[model samples]
Target chain A: MDRLLVVRCPDLLDEDEDGTALRSFVEVVDAVEAYCPWITAVRPGLCSLPARGPARYFGGEDALIRSIVGATSDITPVEVGVADGLFAAVLAARRGLVVPPGGTPDFLAPLPVGILGNPGLAELLARLGIRTLGDFAALPASHVLGRFGADGVTCHRVAGGRSGELAELRQPLARRRVDEQRGGGRPGGAPRRATVVDEPGFWGGVGDTDVRAGRSLAAVQDLLGPDGVVTARLQGGRGPAQRARFVTWNAREPQEDSTLGAPWPGQIPPPAPVVVHPTPLRAELVDARGEPVRVSGRCLLATAPGRLSVEEAPWAEVTAWAGPWPSDERWWSRSRRKSARMQAVAGAEAYLLLVERGRWWVEATYG
Target chain B: MFVASPDRRDVDAPPPGPSPRRSLDRERDLASLAVLAERTRPVSSSQTRLLPVVPPLADLLPDGGLRRGSTVVVTGLAGGGPEGSGGGISVALALLAAASGTGSWCALVGLPGLGAVAAHDLGIDLARSAVVPRPGAAWAEVTAVLIEGVDLVMLCPPFPPRPAMARRLVARARERRSVLVVVPGRAGWPEHPDLHLGVSDMRWDGAGTGEGYLSGRRMTVTATGRRSAARPRHRHLWLPSATGAVAEDATGTGTAG
Candidate 1:
C-alpha cells in the first residue's frame, strides 16, 4: 500500500514572524517521529523526500502513516491526506480527503475546470465541451497533442495516474563536540571537578559555576565550546582572594577556581556552582570607640535557578542596649527586596541579621 | 345774535365731497412703487447642492456632493479621443480620494490589473482598499457583500450587466447607502443618473521655468440633466494645488440656464 501525508499550518499566511513558525514546525515534526520512524516532513519550497526506507522499516505504509498522524496531533494541529502521487496527495489534503489507491483518476474527473490553475487550458477545454478529466483522457492522443503541445501530453499522463520525474534529497552534516577544564583547584575546600561542553545544537547546559566573577565566564567559554555557560560559588576568601566553584552543562561536578586580583588571560576555564542567594543574618554589636550604640545588619540572599534576594534586620542590641528598627523592603519589580536595616556593633566586629518570609536568619558580619 | 346766525349758515353750506383725481393719483403712485422694488432686487440665486463622487472629489463637486447611494457612471472615450488620455485612472482616483476623506473603505470589484502602487501615487490608500478579481458567476454575490459594508464600490465589468442585474445592484446600493461608481467603456447606460458629468481635456499654463511644480490645468466639465438645472452656472476651473485635485475658480465666462 502507498500512503502520503501532507502537513500544513492553517494560519501560515497570517503569522507575523517566520522564526516562530519554523520552530513550531520543527517541534511538530519531532513529535511525529516519536511514534513513527517512517515519517518525513515536507519542507516548504523544496522537493519531497521518498518514504520507501521508513515505510519498509515500519512494517507497512498504513501503519507508518497512522503512527505519524497520531504523534503529530499530540503536539500541534495537523491534517493527513493519502494518495498515489504528491500532487494528488496535496490536493486531496487541501480538500480534506483520504483517497484509496487507484481512485485518483475517478476522483479528479468531476472537479471544476477552474481548479486546474491554467486559465487558457480551462477556457479551451470548456469551449470543446470537455468538462471532466475522463472526457479529456478519452480524446485521441494526437488530437490533444496538436491542440496543447507538450503540456497537454503531460496533463494527460498525470490524469491517467502515471508518475513523473522525482527529485533527489540531500542529507545534513553531523555536529562536533568539545570539552574544557576549569581553575587549578576547587572552592570552599570542597572536592570538585568541572568540565565544560561546547558543541553545536547543545541547549540548556549550564553546569554548576559562579557566573558573576569578572572574567571566569570568559575563561570557561574559551576552554569549552566557544559558547559555554558557567555557574559557580565562592568560599574561604575575602574580596579578590575568594574561592570560586563552577561547572559546565556536560561537566560531572563543580570545579573550584581562584582569581587573585584579575582573571588570567587566554582561555578562562569554567568554575563551580555557587548558591545564587546566600542566607540572611542579624547581629548585635558594640562600637569599637567604647560608645554605647545599637546597630542592625543585613545581607544578600540567594535562591534556586540563579536568583538573588536582600533582607535587613528588624532589631538589634549593642553594648547592653536594645532597639527596634523594623525593615520593610520589596524587590518585586527588580526581583530583589530589602528595606531598613538594623546594625549592632560588638567590640571590633559588626553583625547583621535579616527577616525573610516572617523568619529571621543569620545574614552576615563585617570586620 | 345776527352775526352768529350768518356764520352758522356758511358752515352748513360747505359740507361737500373731495375731487376724484386725488384718489386716482394715490393708486398710480402705489403701482409704480411696487414695480421699482421688484426691478431693484437681484434675481434669487439658486442653491447648489453637493454632488457625491468618491470621497476625495467631494470638495471638487458643487455642493449636493455625490448623492449618497447613487451611481456615478464614468465614461471613457474610444481610441485616443481628447478625453481618454489618462485611461480611467484620473476619475477613479478622484472618487477614491473623496471616499477616503470620509473614512470610507472602497472596493474595486472585477478589476484585477489595477496597479496598487500607481493608485497610491495618485493618492488612493490601497491599505484601506480591497480588490476582487473576476468574481466569477458570483460577482453579484460578492458585490452585495461589499455594498452592505463598504462606503463605495467601484466596478469594471468583464461584461456589461444585463438590465435586471444592473437594476438589482443599483437598488442594493440605495438600500445599503453605498455609492456605486461604474466605469463604463462607452458613454450610454440604460438607467438615468441623479447627476451626469461629461469630462473633457482643458488647456493650462506650462510648468514654471525654475519652480518644481506644474501649474494647474483648466478642465471643461459639462454638467447636464435635471439636477444641474438648479445650479446651472458652468465655468472653467483650474485644477487645485491639493494632490487629490480640488477645483479652483478660473477666469472664464459663465453659462447659466
Candidate 2:
C-alpha cells in the first residue's frame, strides 16, 4: 500500500446537469497538481497523490497537508489527510486526521465495519457479533475464506491494514468525467468517434506510422475510454510493481524513459518476472507435514516448503526454492513494512512469493 | 507478389538540356537522390518484408525473421493455470524485443501490469510500445484496431475466440501487413497460424533450497508451421538469461534449479 494523501471536497461530490460540480472538481485537481504533478482524480470530489515525495519537498506531511488544504480552500471546502492507502486516506480526509505512517491498523481498528462499503458482508458480520473492523480483522484469514469468501477475505485484509484497496469504493466513471472536464467540455456521454484523431506530434514532425497508430489508439480510447490504452514508464524502485508506472496513453505526448537510472538499494537481481500482477494473488506454501511455512523473526524460513498453491488452485510440488530476502521498506517511517520475498519454482513455472504479517501472496510470475 | 516502388522523381526532375551543372555538384545531387529513394521506398519490398528477430530465435522461423503479414501462435503446456503459461509469454515478449528495439511499434493487448523492466532488459524499446492491459469484452475489436497501425500486435485473448472471429483477425493481420503474435494461454486460437511455437521442458536455474537467486530459465521451443516451415524444429534457449535477455543454450543439459 502507498502512503496516499487524499483531497476530499464535500461541496462538489455530486454533479448537476449543467456540469458545474465537475468543472469545479477539475479546477480543484489543477490547483492540487500545482503542488504535486501526479495527483489522481480518483472520483468527482475525491482525488489522491502519493504523499512521500511532496512531504519531503514541503518539509513534512503536516505542512504538505496544511498547504494543500489552504490552497484548495480558496475554491471550495477541502479536507486533506494522509494514510497508508487510498481507502484509509479517504477515510482520514473525511475525518481530517493524519494517521501516523505505520498506525493505519490502529486508526482503522475502532471504525465500524460499514465503512468497508459491502453492505452484505457488513450485515452478515453484524449478525455474527462482529460489529467493528477490529473484530473483523481478528478473524483468521483461512476461516474468513471458507465462511465469507474471497471478497470477505479482501475486506479482512483491508481491515487488518494488510491491504488498502476496496474495488467498491471507486466510481468507474469519475476518471473519465475529470478527463472530459480537463479536455474542455467534451460532452459527458458521447462516445468519441475514431475519425476524430486530432492529436499530432507536439515536437517536430509526426511520422506516417505514428499518425496511423495514433488514429487507431485514439479509436481504442474511444471504445475503452481514455484509461484503457496505457504506456509504461520505468522508474527507480525496489519491487517490480514499484519499478514501472503505467500512465494512460495519450498520442499527443510521446513516452520517454527519463526516470530509468536511479539507484535502489536491496533491489533483487534480474531477470525480472515477466508478469507483475497489479494486485498480488493469494498463495499457500506449506511444508511436508502440511503445516504452513513462515518466515521466522530472524528472517529465516521456519520450515522447508513442500508444495505451493496459488489462488486456491491445485497444489504443485516445489522443485526449487530460494531466499526469504527481507525487504524492510520505509524503515524510517511508521508505515515501514517488514516483508520478505522468496522465489519458489513449481514444475515448469516459477513464482515470486511475498510474506507479510504471516500471509503469503504470489507477487509476480516468471511466465 | 508485385513490388510497389512508386518513386517518380526521375521523371519529375529537370532534364539535362537547358543548364549544365559542375560534375561534382551533379554527383552530389545524384547521391542525395539515391539516399532519398532508399528512405522513401515502401517497407513491403521483398527483401525488407521480414521484421528482424533475435539471432537465437531466427533459426526457428522459416524466414529467419517475423515475416510481415503473418500470424504466429506461441503455445505453452495445456492446463498451465491462468498465471502459468510454461514460458509462452516469455517467448512472445522475446519475439517483440528485437523488432521493437529496431523502432517498430508494437502493441500488447490483454496483458496486465507488463513487467516493463523485463521487457526493457530483453532489449525492447518501451517508448514505442503501447499496452492495452484489459480489453475485456472488446478484446477482439481492440486487437483488430491496433493491428491496423502497430507493426506487431500480441494478443492474449481473454476468452477462446470463435473460428470466425479468429479468421477475421488473421485475415486482418494479413491484409494490414502486421505481425500477429498470439499467446493462446488456455483459450485456444481456432486457426492454425503461419508458425506455431510450442514451449516445453521449462526449468529455472541458479537457485537451490534457500541458496541462489533466479538467474535464468532453460526451455525447449519447437516451431512447426505451414509451407516453407513444414518440418518441426526445436531449439533450446535460456529464455531469460541472468540479465533477462534471451540466449541460445548450446548445452542441451538443462540443469534444474
Q: What is the DockQ for all candidates, taken in turn? A: 0.00, 0.27
Query: Residue B144 lDDT in model 1?
Result: 53
lDDT of 2 by residue, A84-138 (tens): 9888999999999899999999999999999899999999999999999999999
The superposed Cα distance between candidate 2 and the true structure at residue A106, in angstroms, equals 56
**Candidate 2 CAPRI level:** acceptable
Which lDDT tens digits does candidate 1 get at residues A25-110? 55564465454433344442111223456557776656756776677665556555556666566666666566776787777667
Query: Lowest-scoring 10 consecutive residues by lDDT in candidate 2 chain B?
Result: B1-10
lDDT of 1 at B6: 41
The TM-score leader among the candidates is 2
Q: Any runs in candidate 1 off by more than 4 Å, and if so which?
A: A1-67, A70-79, A82-97, A100-367, B1-56, B59-69, B74-89, B98-118, B126-169, B172-178, B183-185, B198-201, B207-214, B220-257
RMSD of 2: 17.4
lDDT tens digits, residue span B1-257, model 2: 22123444452345444445655556666776767767666554422578889988988988788988999999875545568677988999999888887667889998986899999889888888889999999898788778877888999999999999999999989998999999998888999999999988788998899999999998888899998799888888998999999999989835311
Measured with C-alpha atoms, the lDDT of residue B53 in candidate 1 is 45
Root mean square deviation (Cα) for candidate 1: 35.6
Q: Return the DockQ of model 1.
A: 0.00
Chain B TM (all candidates): 0.60, 0.80
Per-residue error for A279 in candidate 2, Å, reads 0.3
